[model samples]
Target: MRGSVEHSWGWGHCAPSPLLLLTLLLFAAPFGLLGEKTRQLLEFDSTNVSDTAAKTPGTPYPPYSLADFSWNNITDSLDPATLSATFQGHPMNDPTRTFANGSLAFRVQAFSRSSRPAQPPRLLHTADTCQLEVALVGASPRGNRSLFGLEVATLGQGPDCPSMQEQHSIDDEYAPAIFQLDQLLWGSLPSGFAQWRPVAYSQKPGGRESALPCLASPLHPALAYPLPQSPIVRAFFGSQNNFCAFNLTFGASTGPGYWDQHYLSW
Candidate 1:
């Protein structure tokens, strides 16, 4: 008589209801966020310069003269002059990260000799269209006007050369892209072929005879977001200390802190 009572739990000794299981599943569902694959295509930090970082068909180290090869942080403007740069001698897989596309990013910095006559360093193809993105992270002058950006022809002759264009004048000017940030230091680009239309340049700031707009209001031609501007199909090039010789430099650091992850498609 003492063990006659049978015991049962909340489920009445049967299976749980489907509603309960569904509720649990709803709470456990994963939030749909972009994975590394999307990051590589859209983010500046994620993009890798595989072609240049690893030895590939298009990217090749330029032949340096005398002293060539160096390294530095683009964010730190205090470092001294570097001599040369070294891209992958051959294409290699980046063990750390992978992308939707096989593209990789390699950072580099260099200095060109004015006497050499090569406005920009010859690293990648300059005879045709190529994506060119740059950031003015730090500059010697320490002002908006001081830092600059460059977009040149990836192939053929550069507009920087007089023979390329009859009235060339985009040379040695601060890139309008930098204006988007810290509006106080810089503004929008001027109204002209160089600012709106994609064209080559060949003039210096102090030496130029034309009056370009000080600020390019509205930063016309929005980047990312609603409308990503056309990919910058041009050559890669830059200068050290405004108005100096065309020193070609690329390394771990060469652009703004965000440049590595983002680039305007050309």
Candidate 2:
């Protein structure tokens, strides 16, 4: 009878002990936080200069200007708009780390442009574990493609972003050519009712200036929310040309932990 007892524990039958299970879960806790906390760095530089001239705009938009932001016209031939512009030092710019009201403001008339090309806009955070909540408000007269979104250039353990090059060239070998966040609009302005739609841009692909959409993964569908019409967007007109306007603001802060091991294991 003892000889007839069934036995098949040679392999693949080991059970996970309680201690082993606890250790495994502890290793996964930080990773769980990684996903929900990661934030997307929407780079606002000149390399992503508007290609169209700022003249009689409709479909073809113009490039942004540096002088508009009180900087020398560093970019040539490209004519974007800057109807009204203002800038102040960032809070971090202070050596004391004291809380100071460091902010920029602009008011664009309808059919005008508003650009911050020189002192490229930035969305800063203490850690990469975060999310971006952007609300674009349009006021005054509205123009075609009256929308606001983000442009990303992935830099993995690299230095600052490359100098913005002409529409046809680039200096940063790791530059990205595609605009990742597509919260675009193409109609008249609505009341200021737009809310922050969360998104996750996984910085996976890291190389060249063209492999954009493929480099990073788009985490959600194109955001769909009601448009806002109050606080008219300050339009920026190009060198004696067309007009366009909009404002960007971050509203909420959240921790990360949704997609850690899934896409950001590194």
Candidate 3:
């Protein structure tokens, strides 16, 4: 009877151990292991500027005098009405106008088509990320250039964005989802010269408080940051809230100039 007994030692005949089973499960569910893709949500080109200008009402008098040309006139040629219509129908009509409390307000959204399918539909955690890329070229006439400051408000509440409107009127609270970048210069550059800088920001509260470096092109116009790594991703996506809309404002420091060639991509 013993001579008739036999057993197979093949892989199919042996059941996997508990540890092996866990490894297989992990491999099957790799959602957390997948890397997030960088998404470009907006791009503003020369045509955008012209279109915005055409849609905006022209000022009877110059918005600013030559003495203070480095003030709100930086975007004089841009029409807020045109800009709002061109992008998403958010209010960004007056790039130079300020709120009653003095905070500059520029509310606009990324071009609708630029939205990426991979971006989460909601804001879940504190690690969501976004980026802004700008390239500005000034006219030939050089003068006392003005420094520009930018405040980007990515989330808001209300019928459209009442909270954003309120924030624009007051300087008291820093919007949790706001990203502020200061000291942008515009004016008098060589014909082919352009400054390209890309800044990435997190969507979490107090995200801007982190000491992230501002990467820019080198002082020499001909030199540039290594393309692949300049705008570094400082955080990983850990939340469900994706920045679907944006409010862009040019702050108190912007100057007047003819931006011959300007580009913005997000």
Please, what are the lDDT tens digits per residue for candidate 1 over residues 97-146? 22222222222222222122122222221111111222222112212111
Where model 1 places Cα greater than 4 Å from the true spot, the runs are 1-82, 86-101, 115-266
On a 0 to 1 TM-score scale, where does candidate 3 land against the true structure? 0.17
Candidate 2 stretches greater than 4 Å from native = 1-58, 63-128, 140-145, 157-266
- Give the alpha-carbon lDDT of every model: 0.19, 0.20, 0.20
- Residue 74: error of model 2 in Å? 27
Our model 3 lands, by Cα RMSD against the true structure, at 24.8
lDDT of 2 by residue, 54-114 (tens): 2221232332221222211222212234211111112233334321322211111111112
Model 3, which residues run further than 4 Å from truth? 1-129, 140-143, 147-266
Best first by lDDT, ranked = 3, 2, 1
lDDT of 1 at 98: 27
Flag the better candidate by TM-score, 2 or 3: 2
Best by lDDT: 3
Q: Is candidate 1 or 3 superior in lDDT?
A: 3
